[model samples]
Target: MKSQSTLLVICSAVMLALSGFSFFHRNKTATVSKKPVRVSSNYRIVIDKSHYELKLYDEEGWVSTYPVVFGTSEMTDKMMEGDRRTPEGHFKIIAKKLHPEWGHFLLLDYPTQTDLEKFNTRKSQGVIPANAKPGGGIGIHATRRNEDRFVDYYYNWTLGCISTKREYAKELYDLLPVGTEVTILH
Candidate 1:
């Protein structure tokens, strides 16, 4: 009787684990409400770092949202190079690069005029370290092929770039053109 109970417990545990995994990895979809929707080329992207969501919007309403991963120090705004925190505030999609490692890189115009000014102010107030440097190359991108498992389980694991699935990255890359505005919020 004891051996039979142990086997039953193990089977139940396995079933629960498999169900949880399937629930988390399910396909995500969205639908528009009755509100007027804007089907325009110029769309705005909003990255909510706290929630790990990247939302797309237009003048009328929301377009779609995708799961995203952030840096180690995702709660704080990026201050300098190697901070591992995604920057917050207004930015623009500057360029897109196709690559083997990152899949597709949708570059952003970080360190905008406002960002620079804030950095200077922080420096003046001694908020940032004296040797700190304002880093660049922040963008939205995808993980390498082998790294998919890490991104799937460990959600917050990017250097500073926002990461999503390769398929979602491709969709976003195709939809957003250069000069599209992206707003990253805390």
Candidate 2:
């Protein structure tokens, strides 16, 4: 009888110890603090010429898209100084500058490889200025007083850059960080 009682006591102690071990092992398997998933640099920018729109794409999907204004000569592709077509190419957001006169502007890589070729070829033919630099005068700029402020919100205007309205430009200026990839598609 005494041996049976001792056996019961030992069994109970073993069962309790096993249950405690199981609980601790379960908790060890379910750790609480895990590292967050990293986000890659896969942002994109798209431009629609017909409707004059600039769209930004993110991981989840189309993050934001804004209406834009283009050149005075909106129909044809830009060829020279007076041709009013926004430069269409792969560009990086170079810089963000606040111009008291122009409000806010986003600089683009204008006069790219093709532009350089044309510039050099023109200089060889004595058509372009000798000291002129390529890839200049390309950015999102503000509208002047005489310029159509209303339509500028929806359509294309200015020399050559993605032109957003005053409100949109302000928002974009805050969002458009440096080194953002910009692809201006015609």
Candidate 3:
């Protein structure tokens, strides 16, 4: 019985050590600069789901790029509600606000006339169910506080929104204005 107790203690110590190491490693690798950069009024965002990157552009050219994660590993265009896929197409930043959990939230104007037309076409063709509805409230935002590991690990944990590091999301929220053009591509 003494020997068994010793082995159990050793195993517990090993597990605790491993968890600590993971925590340290995640924090070290996921750290991002919080320094603010110059904001441009002509800024536009281009999110490439295939590359897991969000690139910012101004009139001059590319400005910066931030690592991003999506809703699903399939990276397919969202079809309907609960699909858990990020949609592809042009969108605009309809609103911007502070989020209680995910930090800064930049709401996107998804389901534009183009998106509606496509959704309706798919419904008519039976590609999507007649009762299906296109989802909304999509946006780009940060992972929850102290949860930068999700972005660092490419976990893709959102319902249908783009996610970045908390610092990066704040930077984006500060730089981008309402009506900014955002394009998502595969």
Per-residue alpha-carbon lDDT of candidate 2 for residues 1-186, written as tens digits (9 for 90 to 100): 999999999998899678542211111121112123224366667776665667777676676666666775355445566555676667777888987666788777676787677667877787756665444778875555444343433434456666666666776677667777877776
- Runs in model 2 deviating more than 4 A are 1-42, 118-135, 145-148, 152-156
Q: Which candidate has the highest lDDT of all?
A: 3
Candidate numbers sorted by lDDT from highest down? 3, 1, 2
Which ten residues in a row are the worst by lDDT in model 1?
26-35
Question: How many Å off is the CA of 133 in candidate 1?
Answer: 0.9
Q: How would you order the candidates by TM-score, starting with the best?
A: 3, 1, 2
Cα lDDT tens digits, model 1, 69-117, are: 7776348888878888899999999999996788889999987888888
Clashing pairs in 2: 69-155, 69-156, 69-157, 70-156, 70-157
Better of 2 and 3 by TM-score: 3
How many times do residue backbones clash in model 3? Answer: 0
- Whose TM-score is higher: candidate 1's or candidate 2's? 1
lDDT (CA) per prediction: 0.78, 0.63, 0.85
| Winning model by TM-score | 3
Off by over 4 Å in 3: 1-36
